[model samples]
Structures are given as C-alpha cells and as structure tokens.
Target: MGDFAEAVRERVRRAREAVAAAHEAGDVYAVAEAREELDDALRMARDLGVDPGAGPEDEHEDPR
Candidate 1:
C-alpha cells in the first residue's frame, strides 16, 4: 500500500511538471497530454479509495 501510494504520488508530480513545462513552452498538444496523465493519476488515486480533491491545489479550486 505504501509503495503504491508513492508511485502514484511520483506520477502526479511528473505530470504536474510536464504540464508546467508545456504551458511555458506554449505547446497545446503537450499540455493536453500532460493533463491526460494527471487525470489518469487522479483516477488511480480514486481507485485506491483516496480523494482526488485532497491535494493542496485541489483545496482552492474546482478541477472542472
């Protein structure tokens, strides 16, 4: 359980970094790809009985 959680967290962190880099580069396609990756990570978290909205960024904003 701990290892799985760590993997999920790592994926989320990478996806976020990709999104930021894509946005900085002004690459729409890359941004979309990164968003998809982020979504997938969030879904994984949900499947593990975790709340996707539990992240700090999620606290102040609605994903949709």
Candidate 2:
C-alpha cells in the first residue's frame, strides 16, 4: 500500500483502539466520540480504497 492508504489504515486501527478503550472506561461521551472517529476513519478508508473490511475485530474472529 502507498503512504496515504497506509496512513488511513493506521488511523482506522487507532480509532478502533480508542473506541475499545472508551467502552472499557465506561464513558458514554468518550465512547460516542470514539465511535464518530472510527466512522470517519472507515469512511476515509472507503473513499481512498483502503479496504476497511478487515479490522481489529477480525483478528479474533473464527475462520468458520
């Protein structure tokens, strides 16, 4: 991947982590904000053809 796509992928990864952390902290506001950021990151990935389908959540998912 080029630099732009790689950067977007990193942003998406960070956004996912932020969302998980916000949920873990039990902060509704932070969770909402993180969700927004994640959404934005995903949108950017789609716009840039960065293949947003696979993410952290997929890491632990079963192949089946």
Highest lDDT, which number? 2
* lDDT (0 to 1) per candidate: 0.73, 0.79
Q: Write the per-residue lDDT of candidate 1 for residues 1-64, one digit (tens) a residue.
A: 7777877878877777787788778888988898898889888887896544445246654222
Clashing pairs in 1: none
Model 2 is weakest, by summed lDDT over 10 consecutive residues, at 55-64
Residue-level lDDT of model 2, residues 1-64, one tens digit each, is 6888888988998898888888778888988898899889999888877886686555763212
The candidate maximizing TM-score is 2
TM-score (C-alpha) between model 1 and the true structure: 0.76
TM-score of each: 0.76, 0.80
Error of 1 at 19 (Å): 0.6
lDDT of 2: 0.79
Which residue pairs collide in model 2, if any?
none
Off by over 4 Å in 1: 50-64
Cα shift from native, residue 46, model 2 (Å): 0.4
C-alpha lDDT (0 to 100) for residue 31 of candidate 1: 80
